[model samples]
Target: MTRTLGIMTEGNDVEALYRRLAWRRQIVLLTGLAALAFSLVLDVATGPAMLPVPAVARSILGLAQDRTVDAIVWSIRLPIAFLALAVGAALGLSGGIMQTILNNPLASSYTLGVSAGAGFGAALVIVLGVAIPLPEAWAIPAMAFLFSGIACAGVYGIGSLRGSSPEMLVLGGIALLFLFQALLALLQFVASPEALQQIVFWLFGSLQKATWPKLWIISAVLAVSLPLLLLDAWRLTALKLGDERARGLGVDVARLRIRSFAIISALTGVAVAFVGTIGFVGLVAPHIARMLVGEDQRGLLPASALFGALLLSLSSIASKTLLPGAVVPIGIVTSLIGVPFFVWLVIRSRRAFW
Candidate 1:
């Protein structure tokens, strides 16, 4: 009777421990959301006109209507600021999903060739001057999204030949990365000087070209993708235990990975398609999220999206303020800031947080 009581006591302790962890995760997510909100207002306020944060906030919320403030906020800066959040969230979520499904801490859309494929497609349009029925603005992103899908198909096709094992899929991605890079280089070699300059600028990544339509497209993609991925959250968490274990858990491990990969491709494609090739958000945000929230997809994925949006919003603010009048490309700022911070995170974490 005493031994039976001890087992009951142990079970209660385990349940309490889980409740504590869950509470802590909730706090972490709330903190990230708070930070993201602050950063978005800051980003809108930091541009050359230098509206006060309260002014920006008031304008954004329709609390006040100064024509000058409204024009600058609604006409100029809001699209850029909001798009940064959307793209960052998309990349962050994509990175989190990719890392989880591939069982590789290092995996991301940028590393795995989806970004490369999109960049190549954009560059091809710029160089060849492709004249589709859509306006030039729409044409490039259309092609970029298209090629991003092709990259997903390529990864899936190649991986399936080897039974869709994670190792085989990763190898296929690396090979495609190289292939796309080489194609991009060749396009650069033959491109006209003007077209080459355009290519170079596009590759640098900027939010300067942001517009309401582009912002809506990405926001819509995020809206659709997030719920769908969240629905599979339990299966994704199960897959982290290892393929055999996940299979034993009645998760269709292969199907789960493939579905996740396709979603990552679409997210990455839409992100880079509009803004060009912003890199480190996809690679860094997920690791930071995982460290804070652990590997449960419900927490990890949304935390990753929040952190990613925060990082890029911060980057966008720096891009404007860094050079005082000339806006710096956001991609440069992200790499410069993200690399050291990422390395520090990697070094400081003593255990394998993955």
Candidate 2:
């Protein structure tokens, strides 16, 4: 009888805990939505065409829809901002998933060699100048995504061979990353100077080339991927308890890992295909979201998505405004900022960070 009472009491405690967590997440979600709205306005306002803030707001609200303002806001600034936000969210979600599945905060979409694969693909496209009989623009991004998927699969297959461990997986990814990067270098050596420039610029990353069509494609991918990720949020939570324990809990750990890897690869591939490697948002946004909303995947996922989107939008604006005319690559800006902060975080949170 006493044991029964104790079990009921524990159940009540768990229920209470979940309720409190849900309430907290609701508040965080609301805040994130409000922030995203503000970011949209800011993104529209911050560009070369010095429009009045009031005009930007009025145009956005459809109260003063001048053709010039519409062109500037919709055609130019809005798409670029939205693309940055989309790419940022995708990378962040990808990183969060990778980190959860691996139980390692350092694991990211880039960590597993997807970026290298995309780079190689883009390199091939640039070096060969193969038109693909499509628009030059479409061919570049399409090829990048294709190569990125191939790279991710190759690394995963090699790492998951019989008796492979996490260490082996990490080693394999690192090996592939360096190997592909070296191959790109060799390709550059044999290519003409113009091809070298194209390859270099693609690697550097940019929103300079953002287009309405590309934005829609990324949005469609995100729409599909984000829902699937949310649906598997429970499995992701189970995964944090270790694969063996998760398996004991009736979760198919291997299948979950593979699904996560594929989704992550697709996300990273699409981003790299369009914007190249805009690094660090994926790694940093999840950590920040976790700090705010706790580690529960249900809340953590959406919060990370919102925060990542806003962070990248702000970074894009800064990249352009920080030096006017000479737009610094978003990847350069992120790496410059993220690397030091990450190192410091590692030092400070020696226990939790690793």
Candidate 3:
């Protein structure tokens, strides 16, 4: 009778602990959503041609009394804000997925060379005058998308040759990074001064390039890919138990990796193609989310996405406000902001999140 009472008490304790964790996760998610909302408003309202918060809201709701204000709000700031949110969410989601599958906290789109490949493809179009049948604006991003896919395929193929070991995939990514960097340098070496300037600026990752069409493209991709990821959340969680253990549970480790790689490449490619290479969001956001919510992918994934959108939206606001009348490249801003946080994250935690 005493043993039965003790068992009941222990089970209650376990249930209480789980309830506490669930409450904490909910709080984190809600906080992230609130931050994202605030950042979006600040980004749209605090630009060079600043608009009042109420005015911005009115314009967005189609009740603006001024045409110019409406145009600025609708045509420029709104799209840029939305793009930042979408791009950040995509990067965060991809980062979370990559870290889980690769069993590497440091794994991200930029580290895996997807950004370098996209950069090379954009450079080819911008510097070497490579043309496709697509419209002028679509050409560069299309090539970037294509090259990013090619790079992921190359990395996967090389890794597969060695049984698709995580270390092999990391090594293959590093190799591709250097190879693409070399190719970009060669293109820059031969580029005309004007073309060189364009190439360099594109690499700087600006949201000034945001358009409704590009935002739609990114949104469509995220809409498709995010659901697939959420559905695979359990499998990804299984992978955290180590590849051999996961495979023993019928996870099909190799197939999961391949599918995830393709999805991540697509997400990363679309993001880099439109916005240039915004680094560190993917690398840092997941860690932040993991630290906040533990390793449960169901919560971690959405929390990561929310944190990412919040970070980039804040970055967008900073880029505009840092200078009195001029905006800086967002990539520079993100690195400056994210690197310090990343260092602190490493220092603050001694426990492995996995």
Best candidate (score: lDDT): 1
Clashing residue pairs in candidate 2 (N, C-alpha, C atoms within 3 angstroms)? none
TM-score of 2: 0.93
Query: What does candidate 3's lDDT look like per residue over 103-212, in tens digits?
Result: 88888888888889999999999876686998757899999999999999988988888999888888888899899999999999999999899889999899998999
**What are the per-residue Cα lDDT tens digits for candidate 2 across 1-354?**
999999999999999998988998899889887887777778788876667778878877788768888778877887887898899888888888878877877777676677888888888888987768877777888888988788777767876884335555566777888888888889999989999988888898898899988888888888998899889998899888887888898988778877888898888888889998777888888887887787789888888888888778878867877787677889888887778867776676644373
Question: Model 3: residues >4 Å from true position, as ranges?
Answer: 1-7, 62-67, 351-354
Q: What TM-score fits each model?
A: 0.97, 0.93, 0.95
Tens digits of per-residue lDDT, candidate 1, 73-125, equal 99989999999999999999999998888888778888888889999999989
Show the colliding residue pairs in model 1. Answer: none
Clashing pairs in 3: none
Ranking by TM-score: 1, 3, 2
Q: For model 3, what is the error of residue 346's alpha carbon versus the real structure, in angstroms, after optimal superposition? A: 1.0
Error of 2 at 218 (Å): 0.7
Candidate of highest TM-score: 1
**What would the TM-score be for candidate 3 when compared with the true structure?**
0.95
Which candidate do you rate higher for lDDT, 1 or 3? 1
Identify the runs in model 2 with alpha carbons over 4 angstroms from their true place.
1-10, 347-354
